[model samples]
Target: MRIDKLHTIDSTNSYLKRISKEEDAQEDIVVWALEQTAGRGQMGTTWSAESGKNLTFSVFRKVKRITISEQFYALMAASLAVKDVLSKLLIKNVRVKWPNDILTDNDKICGILIESVIKRGKLDAMILGVGLNVNQTEWKDTPRATSIKSRTGIHFELEEILSMLLKQFHHYVDLLLKGQFETIKNDYEQHLFKKDKPATFIASDGTQFVGIIKGVSETGKLILLQEDEVVNEYDLKEIQLLY
Candidate 1:
């Protein structure tokens, strides 16, 4: 439960990989940065953080008896951790967008990137990188983007928020190991984007269809109800949710 705070790193996620070969880095060690120059997101996208205005940290945890199929459980835990911290901070309109984006009033406030490092035949460690827009007042002309300070007009201490997030993350991770996926799933569903409403979906072939948001499967596949008769399951990027 001890976090090794690394101040002013280029990127916490990158630093974890740089130090992964060292013998001294232990489990539960967290690498944090006040300013990240080369932060990364899922699929090689650059994660933007305005220096002191956001939360950028990576957590390294050891895992066992879990396959890739269970990776969504870890993501769900992290999403819930953000939700829990924000709720306590009195940020009321927050929700988790499926897979891994945290939103408030339908605007993105956080992004999570989880990477697993497997050595030989067993799981070595998993790196969870979280980027939370905390105190930024303006969002660089990006649509559907927001920050906690912009929404509430109150500034937050990054250190305190980081502490709360780590605690909640560990708690939910324990629930994940206990096979309590339903808890995470239900809570996540409650915050789903356009839940139970007709929405537009753009498939990979550029075909558009109108589907009602149903729910996600246990393995994290998105389920959609099309034409009130056809139900389809989609993996990420296979079907894009049109806002």
Candidate 2:
């Protein structure tokens, strides 16, 4: 339950991992920054956040019994945690965009990046990085972005949001520890964006296709049903959901 608050940082995940290499970093320790000069996102994208206007932090959790193959479940738990808190906050149409982004009403409000440390051919620990827009009013030219303040018309206390977010994290983590994989996956799919609906996608080869999101595999690949009854499973970067 210890949080290391920094006024500014290059990246919370990098800081925690660097310190873990230097010292024995405690499990459940959170590295949060009021501002990040270089925040990270999924697919190696740079996360942009206004100073003191969003939740930019990373949480360290030591893996116990979770197998290496089910590692994506850890990410699923974390994404659901963010969705749960946003749902309780009255954020309408909150959805867990596949792989890791949090979207509401087709606008992304949060992004996550989970980095794991492997040791002895097994998963050791994971650093869950989260960036959520809180009070930022404008996103420059990022039209797909939105914030809590923009959506709710109310400013929020970042620490309070962090506390509630952690609570949800623990709640979902407990379920994960108890081996409720199907339950977690089902809950995640229930909040999935565009689940079972016709959607357009961009493939890595610069090809566009239409498909239905059939849900995700146990290993976290996107299950897509395309034309002529073709079922395709895609890992990250294989396909991108287009608005």
The candidate scoring highest on lDDT is 2
Report the C-alpha lDDT of model 2 over 132-183, residue by residue, as the tens digit. Answer: 9999989886779999999999999999999999999999889989999999
Q: lDDT of candidate 1?
A: 0.82
RMSD values, in order shown: 1.9, 0.9
Per-model lDDT: 0.82, 0.92
Model 1 clash pairs are none
Query: Which 10-residue span in candidate 2 carries the lowest summed lDDT?
Result: 19-28
Give the top-scoring candidate (TM-score): 2
Supply the global lDDT for candidate 2.
0.92
TM-score of every candidate: 0.92, 0.98
The count of backbone overlaps in candidate 2 is 0
lDDT of 2 at 25: 63
